[model samples]
Target chain A: MFDRETITNDRDPLRAQFQGMKGKLCASPELKAALITGTPLHTPAVGKRVHIRRFSKAIAVYAMCALLLLGTAIALPSLLKGMDPTSASSSTGDHDCIPPAVAMSSPSQLYERLLSEPNVVYREVGTIYFQDGSVKTSHVTEMTRRGDLFTTLNYGDGEPEHVRYYDVGGDKPCVYYNRNDLWFTSELRGDNATWAHWCKAYMAVNWLEDEHYEKTADGYKFTEEFIAEQIEEFKCEDAEGTLTFQDGVYTLRVVRHKEQFREEPCESVFEIQISFGNAPEIVLPEATICTHEYEVEVIPSDHPCRYGDETRYTCKICNDWYNEWSPTVPHNIVDGICTGCKLSEEEIGNLPDDDPDNEDHSDIIYGPYVEMSISRPSMQEFLEFYTVFQRKNTAPIVVTDLGDQKNSITQYHFYGGIINKNTFPDDYDYDYSSGEIRVPIQFWYSFYYNCDDAYFGTYDYGIVAENYTLDNDAVIDLDNIRLERVSTGMETFSAKHELSAKGKKEGEIRYYEIYSGENRLMKFAICAVASTEDSYYDSICQQVVDGLVKLG
Target chain B: MKDPQDDRAQIVENYADMVWRIALSRTRREEAAEEVVQEVFLSLFQKERTFNEEEHLKAWLIRTTLICCKHYLTASFRNATISLDEVGDLPAMSEGQSTVYEALLSLPAKYRIPLQLYYIEEMDSDACAKAMGLRPGTFRVRLNRGRNLLRELLKGEGIDV
Candidate 1:
């Protein structure tokens, strides 16, 4: 009777026979030649041939005339206009001295003219005073065209605090942070809408119909008032503005009032100046554009061709392909040559009245047999090989320092009958009640394979604490760290440290440090603390220490 | 750095035996097994694939071999009448062991392939499940059912297994 043990444990003679067959098949001379020459014994059927006979003489002449016409159509415009005068003049002085096309009479007229113009430059300054005595000021220099807009705004000093660019008619505008090489896109409304409105208002004389108009010595002067009813649409309580146009320049002054709460009144004043012609060029720092390109190369079969060898094909990106091989009928071999093909063996056993349909067929035996060792482990063996000691609690405990510039504080968690938070006297305050470890630490139960073919199950956890200082007088010994430096052959010093405490519940901690020169780059610690003298905890801890992988 | 061509050759050499074993377990014919192994290796060689470890490579080969075996079986020109007797002879074994081998081969391809990977290849149930694209629990159920079927077949043949 075959039990589960026998089925799982018994060595199958078939496996050995098959393995021997594989060795013989791979060592075949035909396969070796095919692999080296990169050629198939049977040529693949060619796809339907696309035959294009020679073009007729009349058709060829017609195609030539069409090509000539296309060339003439492309060249006609450039030939008639010659070289552009503006492009030919390379001097910046000559370009800047170009006169304005016409004088703009009104704000609306100026805005209409500027919309058609390529570049328009202007500056706007706005200051707001709140009831709480808080003040915010924004000074901006900007340039704009039909679909393009660029602006630099300063909140405090003359230096730009924020720089933004918007291709107005297209996608989202990308704002660039100069301090950090950070760029992000946001929606077209909110602050961006306000900037767009300011730029349009600078060129136009009567963006909003004026409440009062007066003729000044230099140019036309106009004033407009937005009451509480109309202010909501403009995102303000009430607003009053006056605009003056003089000699291709427009000056605007606006005051806005808002009451955020019942008693908190806020007021803002804006001064804007717009000048026609000669807008400075907008230059942007280079940035990488994220894209992907797929490159494919076909790889032929690596092995030589056998009696039945499939066509090998490959695409270099993801491992996906179509494979086909010729099928061959099994044939009997006598003296290393196929007897089925020769018909010699059948002729020797000839019976005059033998019917081919009723004849019995026997299996063909192939040559050059090799010994195969097939000893499969039983179920019990598998269990023993895969079993290992693993900790129940895989949650990570993190120690952090929170103190003044020089003060150092270390945190620890000790669990023995109940959870206890231990706080020592130090200059820094420690809070562990949150139960959430803020540092980048991850923990999970995982299986580990040992050298003895046994699995040592472990509570896998990793710590990522960067540039942490260990005070000399701290409870944990700082100088007694047993460090083993690993040469990664890079500019960083990678090391592992093992430290253990013998008193009370035996605790073991494994610390890994990565340093660049004298500066400590990163420090990670994996600790296993137990209250009792349990060997399982120690074994699991040891396994975890051995399985530590340094991430660069 | 290893040249791409050399790396491909090494991959083919190292995993050819395993791929053939898997293919043979499914098709049960030497020619079909050879065809499936060639198809699987050629498919792997043609693509740009990155394996994380040896386990991943073996798993990919096993999975691809099974897929190729399926494709070969479904081909219009496939000779379904090709019996085990026509292919080759097994190494001499006792009557009971021989019966067990026949019973195992008689099981459906889905159940037999997993059993072969688990018992013959010595892969863990998890690895077998991954290669066969089955959940661990589902694979265990299928394996148990397959063993029961084999046991019944052996009993019918008047040999307890």
Candidate 2:
């Protein structure tokens, strides 16, 4: 009935073009040579999304053997007293490669970075997933981003919601939004209303819990409690969220909160797609009730022991008012016992112990430890020293900051005073013997994604995987590491090692030689931005800790 | 004495064009297509895969090309490159009459990919669907839509389809 040659007849419009394209394009010389040589013609590119070549049987064997060998060397438990950030001594790690300006970031850092983008869009798709594997997608909240300057259209749902934008025309950083004429503006220009509002709207997850410093081989995976009260419609309770970070960024986050006290269980789920598409402009409607005059009702703050005096001002009419997280009230210490919460001085001393894995604090601030302000780099400086850029305060993986530096090779910074099972020994039901890492194996899995996200947030370039990795002795002398730039560069990270991990992380493949007496294990991570496969000069990635790790 | 035949080199030579064309259809830029081809073959050479059948190898190449295309065209990649540099924009190209190539290029990406694989590579609907990660029924629907769209595009240009 049909033949190949006859089917490619002139009757088909594509016949001529296909043949033309075929003639013009051919295999390049490098490709042919690489095929013959069995070497890669081009190094694989990194950033956004990456596909892992499934390890073969032989390679898997070799990898297992290597992990076994590595296990012996890295297993020696190391200890470091963590800096409480408010009071107590600075427990800055003895990291030698600490950048001058940037601090290492936490998983929360990704949200901060995404929210900071001017031209970004996030579609918070809420789906109610049941234990039976059925799902009911209820609502979608689409937030439009335009960096600090881009105009945003809040709708890809056919119906455009009221657009929000920043206006330099009026005054300070002001966000104007109107939903069907009920217009309002944020006090972000004068106060911290903008940041506080962003905190409430998105990125409400507090990563300062006990989950930090833990390790996930492929990506960073962490779990935290999901407040059931946040969702009124779903009526969910005892919610817990498991977030999976494939590379350095979280690709999937599944939050499971059950409907209140039901024998048959269900969970609430939401997937946020960080859209890079340009925001279409919409004319703002005439403002009717833009400003809200709240009847000032002062809710007495909670004790410094819990929630630090929860004081909030909500407008009498609408949900509009100034919100702030005031510092913890001074503890009334009389004869070594806190009069307010009855916590003893000796008990507080025992809080900061030898365990180097987690910070025992949750939502509680101890003493007068204020969030110290650090200087961030200028925009021009940030762009200049991006990927593969030179760093100023480079150091050997040696004991430079040996003076009282906490050698706790950890991935998390635990804030003190949180009344958790570990923080308060009052919970007899708590198991102290479970999941304690006294000798934490320190490694740096900083994602120096100075490179662009797949135009937006949908793609996962596997480069984010093994690309930015550091496998070394857990402790680094961090006191000398200064903060110079806050941008995500591979260098310039300071104690601000913990803007919640270090200064702007970059992608230069920096090596830290680890010494175990006779044997030397070199741990170095290459930035996906700096060491893109296109930048073929970064042959050191071949010595990736996850892949073909070169050992001597 | 002749050296052992390099299977990798022979394989690359065989499929580089198909992979590049499929990538070109998706990405539209020569550079992006070339880069995608490189990644596909490099992935092939690096993996310790044993392809028993010729169709299986072809399927792998097609699948890989599709994946690379999905990852290749991000905002970061666009910003990283100087320009898209489409084939039509080259100085030597003729102008005036809209060629079948231009008409085909004008279609949406979803249709263009299936059209190229089904018509250009002469792949059946089932094989094309499998490669594109689509159901056989869905693939048939897309193929019809593509044909209709192409026919309309050509008819508008005063060409018989």
Candidate 3:
């Protein structure tokens, strides 16, 4: 079983640590009083109370409602007349809201009545059945006033193929391209205008000439046919249409038996059903309007004309440019340089032979190479020496030496501070070649809770680098070094060792060494009393070593 | 007679630890956890609400702490960049305990909150589901997944738990 006990027990220590924090977290007395009283501690002049105080102004709303009710009753009939579905205009009271008892005599009268209704929506579904028995379905939705807000969703094989929204109320009508996710506006009024113009031009018909009218149980019906010459002009063998009106809606359908054009047998059908009602509210996205305005001017090329080059012209308005290529002589190269618009060598010699003594000699060298030796270490070598002392400390475990600010070495003094208040012997030397820095420090650890008798010792604490090349001269013993993987935003290994120095006892001095890479090694050593129990100093030393980061 | 201010204080005193732990587990930042704790308690102070039982109060605190932690993480003005050194000083824990805490902190938020509520708060799967506004089945699945991920992460760090 997975150990859930570990996670449950992990918070025990933290809970104990936070046990008494509630006393420190109590709200102030003033805050507690404000909370109990439900009053704002810092009240603003413009506040919620001010808004509540203004509700007394609502008494006039009832009087306004009574006036509106009286006005509505007086204008109710004209309002009903204006909203009548069958009439084109309120002034024309010829058509009733209900279908007339007398049948409409012609298809023209039906079409005129259907087109005249305001706020009407229609959906037309047409299926084209090919001679080969394949079928294709198409759908179109039309609305009069709010047609701009209508969306037509077309389905193919029981799945949505595309959606199109029309906005006709704007200055120009537009079709929203669902696939492109954009609206495309047209200069024409709308689809209805285009269809009306096409019908008038190609399929001109006189509904009265057909003289076919019937009154069905539902409503009236009318049928009309185009002339033979008009049918021929429309590329169809026959063209006919039917119109019906019932329940405040009109249905118009047209069928054209197309003559075989391009050796394909097909018939085209169009149907429109119109109903009058208030259009549904449609939310439209803010659309980007297309605008075009640019001032065009010819700008000549700023560069001088070269041989075999072309002249270029740019528009100052939009920086659009074009180049006109023309034939020209190529430039000649003399002494690995272009000689275009340059004087000959004889002309150059005639201009400059006046001052022989004043010639520039800065580029000429005066002496051969000389060698000198200085004992100061390079910046990289100096930082390596400095990092050894920094790695020995428990705090500021990570030190970044950015090197000298301005080509001079930055010297840092260690160990001779007021805290320690001790002077080192004159013979105490730092081994810079091996990257070693040794400082004498006192360290102590207690094992058995006897503060007075705790182990106190002094020893030389230092850091050393052991460079191991690929040739195995100085290999670390894997068995002897206790490795702990540490991450300082970069992975490295820390080696812990308990060893006896020249004067300290074995297992009394602790050493922590971090291996940066194959070449550089940083070590921290402290003298302490080591027992079988885990030493807190070891963890602290490990933390310091883990913080080591190379900033070179 | 007991006043509402005393009731609010009693609630804060009782549930502050659980709320702080949940916030710390979710945010993985001590300062952010402290801020979430303050926000949760301040909301409880401002709103006059009644709970059916002590369990309901605990659930409300956990839920509010999770929300506050999420808000702190996603607030536009919150600093997005925090260095590893800034997160170095965790509340003192044993080395092994620190390893477990790191493994828990490394988990994704969805799994971390449910795991902390279930294991640390000793809330059952149903209670945890109610606190997180999740179905019992979904909470169980997340708990199991979170446990497995934590086990793998601890194993990678050479910790058995």
In order, the candidates keep a fraction of the true contacts of 0.00, 0.20, 0.01
**Number of the top TM-score candidate:** 2
Question: Which digits, one per residue and each the tens of the lDDT, describe model 1 over residues B11-123?
Answer: 76677667766777687776676666656656565545566577767877787677567556544121354445534554355555555565666566657887777766767
Give the docking tier of candidate 3.
incorrect
Clashing pairs in 3: A148-A166, A148-A167, A148-A168
Chain B TM-score (model 2 vs. true structure) = 0.85
DockQ for model 2 equals 0.10
State the lDDT of candidate 2 residue by residue for A102-180, as single tens digits.
Answer: 2212112212323344344434322222122332222233333343432333332234444544442332334344434
Worst ten in a row by lDDT for model 3 chain A: A416-425
For candidate 1, write residues A5-84 as lDDT tens digits.
34654554333422323233232334333333344433311111000001111111222222222222232222112212
Q: Can you list each candidate's DockQ?
A: 0.02, 0.10, 0.01
Query: Which lDDT tens digits does candidate 3 get at residues A1-552?
Result: 765545554643333422333333233345334434444444312211121111111111111111122222232222212222332222222211222222221112211222343244333222222112333333222222232343344433344433444443454333342322212221222223322222221111112111222235743333322222222233323445554456744444445443211123334445444322233236644432211111112222222211111122222211222221100111122222222111212122322322335555343221211111111222222221122121111211112221222111222122210001121212132332332222322111111111222221111223222331212122222223232221111111122323221222224334444332222223333332122122453353333323322222
- Candidate 2, residue A393: the lDDT equals 18
Docking class of 1: incorrect
Q: What part of the reference interface contacts, as a 0 to 1 fraction, does candidate 3 reproduce? A: 0.01
